[model samples]
Target chain A: MSRDALQESLSAVMDNEADELELRRVLNAFDDAETRDTWSRYQVARAVMHKDLLIPRLDIAAAVSAALADEAVPAKAARGPWRSLGRLAVAASVTVAVLAGVRLYNQDEIAGAELAQQTQQPVMAGPQVKGPAVLAGYKESADTTGPMANGVLQGQSGWQDQRLPGYLRQHAQESALKGTESALPYARAASLENR
Target chain B: MRAIPLLTLLLSGWFALPAHADEAQDWLTRLGRAEQQQSFQGTFVYERNGSFSTHDIWHRVQDGQVRERLLQLDGSAQEVVRLDGRTQCVSGTLVAGLGNSRDAPSRALDPQKLNQFYELAVIGKSRVAGRNAVIVSITPRDQYRYGFELHLDRETALPLKSLLLNDQGQLLERFQFTRLNTSVVPDDRELQPSNDCTPIAVANSKAPEVQSTETWHMEWLPPGFQLTNTSARKDTQTKATVDSLMYEDGLARFSVFLEPISDASVTETRTQLGPTVAVSRRLNTVDGEMMVTVVGEIPIGTAERIALSVRGEKKPAAQP
Candidate 1:
């Protein structure tokens, strides 16, 4: 492409008004030193016009290009039987990972249930029949089997397990009652109450 | 070479941004007024990380009043009834000592106010609930809030589907209508709450004396968030007075709860349940140690920050 046309395309790209063809043209000519210089000069002019603080000497595109050139390409000679062997190894590892993950998940659920049982012993024996509070905490433990799933606070069982559920329910119920878009908040509150 | 033409193009592109934004704003305005003006009933499914529940909703608008009834189809029978934005009843479990303190007037969906915190744009069109829908994306301007993708019905402007996304563009929660009937206005029988649905008690005539005295303030709040409600209630179990404050930035909301914890066992904790996150921090106050817990549909980091910023306002000396 002509330098003038390329410059026009570059300006259009800078303005984010370039069509796909113009963008392609500018990108294709971007590797040329003259084109790069013109682009930076245009950027400087635009920065001056817009009063934007810019590092005029910083050319990220040139830096990136140099990095790309310096990057070592991996050997592509290995083929056939070795590639299949590698794929088999990957498949075997994936299966092992899946099995381990499932086992870990089961263990987490068991641990969560045990912790929940321990917490419930006091509440169950207490005279104050705060049914919702107990149920809310129980439901949370049951729902969140994985420690990090849904960002559940797992392993920390002292005050949060006893109080967090109540706080969450209160917040949801309050939001539901006061909210204008009733369905969303109501759904949220109802979801909390689900056992 | 083509400097003048390029400048004109750039200027035109800059001017075009607001025009697109205006269209999104118009759609949002229509969505805001859709519920009050248009009566519709539908079945929607609410899904979060580990929970999924289907619900049937009956909404009727008659004589400028909006009545809505929602019932869960599976699991426990969770029900709620509302009249003209005020909650009338709730089924199943009702938290003790809740709804006693009257909150500030419920604010309608204000597009103008929302535009400050969120960048509203019409992304594209889609089909939802077997109806044509326009997708309006509400992107948070900062990291403090999550973004929302609302699929509004093209015909009635009612929201057919809504998706809450975190900063990583991960789906936190989803509310989508599986079936909607805009033409059929739900009758009185459909809007009636079930016997299981217990009516919420009206606000007490006599305000609690402690409401005036107990004061708590935040050192810093995320931009665009405003204090929407403040209430003090005595915990039925712990017997401790809990001061609660609710803040919202038009679209997103969060609540801050401060309760004096004399027990030293409570440690700082943070957790996320789908779209909602709860963060607890121990705050040392003049009187005692207070546990400040922030619970809302906000980012965990933001909730943590808010929890840290809770400060017990110093009480003035006795005048007498």
Candidate 2:
């Protein structure tokens, strides 16, 4: 590709208005040092406009690429009767991507943090009942890395279903008894009985 | 692909009713006050994953004084009694961590403050516990918070049921009163924690006291979240100082713990048994090599960012 075409492709990507063809063109030329530099420059410019902190020459893309590369598998091609195999390959890749993405997404979303946002439904919870006047705490607000985010629930067996409730009950009862906010904790523990 | 248009149509119709928001919040405010002022008693059941229990509650409001008691009707005689919102006594398996009887200020539900994080709307109506109810939806304004839907008693404005939901409306947990009566009040005997109800010991496991900000700071935090407490606890056995800082955005809360790992080969670990997420990241600070572990119910990406944002206040340049 000519330098001008590459530059146009880079600009389109920076604007987030690039078509799939344009994205392919830029990604194809990603190996060239000059092209990479230009891409970084465009990213810096865009970052500046968005008021995001721009670390000059920071290789975040390198880190992301490295993270993505290690988990990459040779995806099976979509073909006739063997499409099931290809679907399985896609599912495997998605799980890998989601696991990595979960770690990054947890900081902002403290609880019930959903990953694979594109494919998964966000998990919800019931009302937050405060304990009596001991002290108020956002209970486990930062523990968003629960089972739902792990995406293992799709195939959850009886074992997980059985054990998870026990753990949850134990934790809630323990928190209510051990901590302040007697009423809220008691309510939380009691709420477990609501069918 | 074919459902996108239909979904959009539903969404547009959903957003079209703007006046409904205020109506929903009004119901939520009522539910917040229901238990305090209303004298009601009934048998309620709580269910989650593996645990299920049934309990009877008696609430009395007289001369501006509110007294309440809860008893597990089945299995063990798990029980608790409270005056206003403070626990008086308890029975059965009361875990731990609840503050002492006369100590620790109780934080009430401040609907106004919570409004900052959640958008309140009365989405629709529903029936619960054999009563007509109004559905109040509290939609989170940001990714940091979760949304809630409450079914309030039409007459007393008390919350008969509440549902915590994510953006996609998947139910995580539910709390509802199976049966409630506002006119009935229980006797003095009902408002008591069971015989085994022991008072919580906060003084023994007191949180550590933070010395000074001369130690470390978070480089970034989600807007509206503020640091509420900082402490430094030394493990008696290991003699390691574990620094913990807690932050809350009124409704949502999180804690960051920093500890030194000297020559200890602990790989990065993440675990979530239920609604909790724990993440530990190794970072180099001016004080030497330390591990930053963030435990909360937040998303992993947010936790990762928080882990990376922890910087030594004494040396901001020390980031890895």
Candidate 3:
């Protein structure tokens, strides 16, 4: 339940128009958007009828949301069922973002950066290198006979000499030719051909 | 004796429980030890972008020293020999300019610092290099790093295959062996580099010089990243010097290359390959029109911001 639904249910109770079942339903979904909107509407209507500007606008839900956003609003939430409500809200938002495309971009660095060595590049040095630049050196080496250009393997590690780069190149090329969905892989393959 | 099979089955199940979800750390630990301890030789394939290659690696550790050699089976005799963990000789066109190999020291694998940016766990199990293997995962803790999953030979702790993944779980690259042999140690002749192998003069070496302060500096950086390496090299074609700097956050790394352009017509360009995104932005440095090209495995938006953030420190402050 969200904060809005609860406030709406409270408004219903004040009007004495809601029965036990309706009250329960309102309480259950009090934090919901629809319920909050209805609650705020009822409050404004009641205030207008009573000719009481004691609480102008009576847009309780918006104020509550702003309070939550600012976090400067008092946490006068009742310690009862609302505790579970907060947990449910957080989990809901996370699930939505995870299920949706709202990924948090905190950790997504370029792939294979771990291969780059980290140096203390103080200001005494020119500019600093950030992240894992593991294979940047090889990018510049993509030439006519470069291992990548030839689409063949190179190295002295007995097995890697025969294999590692082949695997890397195959993944790139296969991804380029096989996928019909997007052009990203094709672009990558083309980049490899850039020499 | 009759109950032994049942007992063994129960014991194995218990052992497997701890490895399932915590694969990232286990995979990294396996990779850290794989090349050092595993004695194996096999053919494997590596692929990225428009290229694919087949090669063989023979790694053996004895008397506390690692001896390894690699050979490209399909192409010319591209070979290398490493006594401990350093490159001895290389037989390839890339290293043709042996007169000036970068003076940076050889980098070592450090599992301790890697964990700061990556979440290590065990994701699943898979077979690789024709051997039973365990899968270990390295997931980035934030958007500043890519992820890797490694399959290690169960018996020897050697990496049989490795996969790089982006934030969306898309595969970027793969390195895996098709066959492997653990019984025999590779001979010295197999570890030898080809005729093209030329020994680098280790005694006479110099780091690339850093150019003037008016070169470049970025005003914006993701939370904890800082500059790490910088060098200036004279461009052969234009005869103008280009300044480059690299930055890293323990795990993630990127490089910013600054080259001055003679004309004002340079355009901003962006490209993406797997998890790597490169963005080049034009900036007016006091010296002239400078092109700041940021190349790394990062989001396109972040790359753009970094490109825009570059400023030359020595450029005189603009008058109001």
Candidate 4:
């Protein structure tokens, strides 16, 4: 693109008047020093026009770019049938790491469950493990092993167990009472009280 | 030679974008007016993280007045009745010292205002509640809020199904109608609360003395959010005053509650129940330590940010 055209696109982007193509063009040209300088100049001009205070020398985009440039890139693996196997191994390890992280995070919940088991007190049952029945069949229920399952906070004995439920109920009820959309908020509140 | 087709492709996309947006905007406008003008009753199921429940609704609009009654079909027979957007009664355990922001009028769904924060587009057509429907996708412009996919009935413009999705495009909650009958206006008998539905007390006598002494403000907030209501109510059990602020960006809402905490053992907690997330943080103020809990149908990260940003405006006398 011509210098004038690039400058025009930059100004258009600055004013939030750019179409997709103009935005693309401006972003593509952003690596050029002159483009960056023009963009900063436009920012200064706009700020002056709006009577807004601005540190003219401060350029967050340039600083971010510099920091990003300094960051290390992951080395690419050699291409082979082994690459796919290697990727699978990496994925498996990542999954294991994530599961381990979750288990560690839910220590309190596990402890609570153990306490419940020892006490022989019936813990609130988790959401029924059911197959996807709705449209798109995106699983409707989230992971059930977390701190709260089926709207009942589990394994939590102190402040959260007592205050969190009331706070959640209050928030939902207040939203239901104050909301304009009506049904959704009511459903949310009723869902909370279901337990 | 390839330039012509590319130009045509770009031109088509450029032309098609606004048309889809306009169609979606029209559908939203119809939805905003649907509740006020149309009367419908239906059975809908609400599902969140760990909870799922089905409910029946009876909505009637007569002489510019709207009356709605909802009853949980299963589990505890929780019920609520509203007249002209105001809560008239609620069954089941009511939270003690519920704030009296009854004077704050309910806000209407404003598509124009929503457009500022969410990109609205008519995604496709669908069949819902045995009725033809148009699907509208409302994608948030920022990461701070969740997105929604709404299926509105073609004839009535009422929502037949709604899905809330997070940034990863995971469904957080689903509200879909299984049956709807708009042709029949619900009678007064259908709108009446059952014996278990207790009437909501107005609490008019204590209204004047419930003024909040401390002014709390946020250091940062997600763009487009505006404070809709602020209330101070004494906790019935603890007797500590709880200051609450509710914020909304036309479509989504979240509430922040600040209460003085004397217990040093209490730690910050974060948890999510379905679409709603609760994040509590301890804030040290001039008075003492206050627990700031952010509860909302927003992402946990946003809730945590809000919890951390809460600041009591009261300063020590020495700090000018």
Top candidate by lDDT: 4
The local distance difference test score of each candidate is: 0.76, 0.58, 0.54, 0.78
Once fitted onto the true fold, the runs of candidate 1 whose alpha carbons sit more than 4 angstroms away are A1-154, B1-18, B202-213, B316-320
- Write down the C-alpha DockQ for each prediction: 0.18, 0.08, 0.05, 0.23
- Scored against the true structure, residue B105 in model 4 reaches a CA lDDT of 79
TM-score to true structure, per model: 0.69, 0.56, 0.57, 0.70
- Candidates' chain A TM-scores: 0.39, 0.35, 0.25, 0.38
Q: What is the lDDT of residue B216 in candidate 2?
A: 69
Candidate 2 lDDT by residue in tens digits, A133-163: 2111123222333444322333344433433
Candidate 4's C-alpha runs over 4 A off are A1-145, B1-18, B202-209, B315-320
- The candidate scoring highest on DockQ is 4
Compose the digit string of candidate 1's lDDT tens values, residues A9-64. 99999999999999999888888888889888997798678644443244556544
| Comparison by DockQ, 1 against 2, better one | 1
lDDT of 4 by residue, B1-320 (tens): 32244345335433544468888999999999999989999899887776678999999999999999999999998899998888888888676656466458788899999988887888778898899998888877667998898999999899999988776556688898999999999999999999888666743234333556578999999999999988888777788888899999999999999999999999899998878889999999887899999999888889999999988876334323
Instruction: Note the clash tally of each candidate.
Output: 0, 71, 84, 2
RMSD in angstroms between candidate 3 and the native structure over all alpha carbons: 17.7
Question: For residues B283-303, could you state the per-residue lDDT of candidate 2 as single tens digits?
Answer: 887677877777554555666
Q: Which stretches of candidate 2 lie over 4 Å from their true place?
A: A1-195, B1-17, B71-80, B89-104, B201-216, B228-245, B258-263, B283-291, B312-320
Q: Candidate 3 on A55-168: residue-level lDDT in tens?
A: 323233343444354432222363678766765665564454343222211111222232221111121012213423434323321331223233333323342233223223
* By DockQ: ranked, best first: 4, 1, 2, 3
